[model samples]
Target: MACSLCIGTVLPILRRMRRLAVLLLLVLPHGASRGLEREAFEVYHQRRRAVSEAHPDGLILLLGYERQEAQAVRSPFRQENNFYYLTGWNEPGAALLLIPAQGDGSVYQELLFLPPDDPSHEKWHGPRAAPDDADIRSQTGFESVLPISKLATRLSRAAKKRSHVYTLFPHRAGEGKQPEPDRREKLQTHAGELPIADIRAQLEAMRAVKSEGEIRLIRKAVDASIAAHIEAWQEIEAGLYEYQILGPMLAAMINGGCLRPAYAPIIGSGPNSTALHYTAGRRRLEPGEVVVMDVGGEYAHYAADLTRTVPVDGVFTERQREIYDLVLYVQRKVIAAVKPGETLRGLTHKAKRYFDEAGRDAAGEAMGASFLHGVGHSVGLGVHDPIDFSQPLKAGMVITIEPGLYLPEEDLGVRIEDMVLVTENGAQLLSKGLPKEADEIEKLMRGR
Candidate 1:
């Protein structure tokens, strides 16, 4: 412990010693364009800039992440996707600052502070930023990039003139550390780690409506998911185990440019399907049994979430048909309900009514124990992207309407999901190629 503290204290001086030589090599190859990464990064910067300007007073956004555990052990921190979105620095222990466009153009107005590299450290782990990580600055287009220790100083200054700090830091916002009140030197918060509800309004207000570019990326994500699902279904057979289907499906996603799984690939067979959050790898599929797969792929880091429950063989059993049709009908009705003004919570209540109404006619006492979970959730960087908790939907919103009916006793669950985009005409289904109709799915299963 004593040696660790000595190293930490001495590192700053060591970093300064190497700063001059490193600064001279500031310019690198300058060709780090990774296709979709570059595109998404551009959109992310523009929107973050807009958020700063929208509030005018300035926003202090704090974001965090967790890492994939290393070969011996996975690291606890995976950089928050949003933080990676704006800054493109995947390292943990980093923060970004977007100072409302300077009254006069200056270098450090909108900046990013990241952990600087150390040779002794990198030798133990891996490469990190040098004293001159201008490539990071150039790629992210931030005004400047500096060490993270400077953040409180930066915030202290911004709070002097501006009055609020908008952040995506707290997981369940409005509950943690609310900013200290200083009407004389006010600080606003977006996701109020509250006691300071002062900044919550702008946080929800900005992220609720998707921009045109955001919608385009989400559409691409949906298209990739459709391709993955179709591929998963095409290889399906009664003898194949449920988890076997996930490999190829996810293959299509990676090849199709979905860099990450929207969440986990849930390829559930038999009663396993009844477990809503099943993470795959299980039971063999029987001829007449239904398979419920809730899978999603991330394209340009935006999520494409979809769920489809289908027969393992070429046809559905009579009992399967009854529940499948009911699920499809309710899902269709819910899709129709996704206009430009429905709150997910409100729409969920409406969907629950349909499920209950159907129960009244068919199963009667089932929904309580059987049809567990909500209709669906918001999808984005973190699968359930944080945005708009208290507002009505707008045009660019992308949502999934999946109304499922699960019967564990009978060993069946039917859920058909499609990602829909809110449009001027109504809703546009982005996963059109997956063939959800009973006839279409059965025929596809039959190999015709």
Candidate 2:
């Protein structure tokens, strides 16, 4: 009886411990005590360490997008990629400053500067965190948070210390706009003695590898996108405008938790499909034409890219199947060859060989020539996330393998795309449950 009593007491304690562990995972972000979806503190810290290693004793400054003036249309805000990478602060008009450790590697500091909260403005735009908000430290895990006005004074002090400022200062419009009387002007003139480097290349190389948390978010995006594609495949019919099909596509993804489409949804039908990046989703479908739906969505700021060519009707024509099968054959070969240490160039070359050897028409015109554009690109925070395409594939990288054959003469285009994650041994298809084979697609459409 005493042993039974002890067992009962131990079980409840163990259950309570498990519950606490799950709670910690849910609230892992240091300043996320209020239940916001903040990126785990480790992600930003790891990236900061990477930058520090690249430029020890240097100051890294990253600017964020400015809040747009109130106008007729107010779009949701998007965070800057580089700034988000370092701090994961979702608010607009914020900036990040990172100071690498001292010569003894003992003084690493990361500060997030923010716009002070104004109750009057908050009445219009909703409540926002101030520099002194307790949540700022918990949500961002930054060593310090300060008001935006302090930025000028801080930069002046750093300038006097002769610190090299590494930043993407000459940013193009719409990439990420800076505040008025741009801080960049100060960096150039006040810190004229210090040399500034772009540091974008270093960040790109680091972002190429995905962490476990990042992969989970990416997987969520791919799953939502697959659902959107399936909805399009089932609802498409002759005489329906491309936008009509896009309606269900958007609904499905949004309902599945995607914030928005990763890129402009490409719904190209018939001759329109011949254009690589067609965005006009207004074309009405015809009985015999094929449609290409290149669509994906973002989940937690991560992006997914997927493309599938489907017939307007339930089944493919004899000629359409031939081209589709050829692209599929090349895609399968390329996917099977993906593994750590493999180069994208080598895989593209292999695809070219297959297309040449088996895809030539009777006229001796190599059909492979129609295969324009690279086979794939990395996908992450940005749809076409910056990556070294020629570098060897490494584990933890998520990329898309899209191979297409556009035959303008025949008014036919076929492209198949799938997001893949590099693994220790080979590659894992993040979009595995999605049907890509012609037979499977036909079956799904017929069932609808």
Number of the predicted model whose lDDT against the real structure is largest: 2
Q: Which ten residues in a row have the lowest lDDT in candidate 2?
A: 27-36
Model 2 lDDT tens row, 1-448: 9999989867754654554445344334431222124468878888888887788757787777676521113445667776777777777778777777676545777778899988998888898878988777876687689998887677666554535888865434432133233456656653466787777788888789887878988888888789889978877788778877787677666655676787789999999888898988878899988999999988777888999999999899999999999999999999999999988887888888889888576567787788887888888888877666689989999988889999888789999999999999898999987898999999999987
What is candidate 1's lDDT per residue for 1-448, written digit by digit as tens?
A: 9999989757654553354234223312221121145345566677666666676655545543423321124322335555655555656556677767556553225667777777887797788664267587664566577777676676665565555566642334342122222321222333232122244345445555666766777877787778778777776776677777776676666666666666668888888767777775678888778889888877665788899988888688888888888888878888888877777777777777887776553455745345566676666555666555445777777777888877777778888888777787678887777788888888877772
lDDT score of residue 115 within candidate 1: 70
- The per-residue C-alpha lDDT of model 1 at residue 18 equals 53
lDDT measured at residue 357 in model 2 versus the true structure, 0 to 100: 85
Instruction: Assess every candidate by TM-score.
Output: 0.75, 0.86
Measured by TM-score, how close is model 2 to the native structure?
0.86
Candidate 1 accuracy as lDDT? 0.65
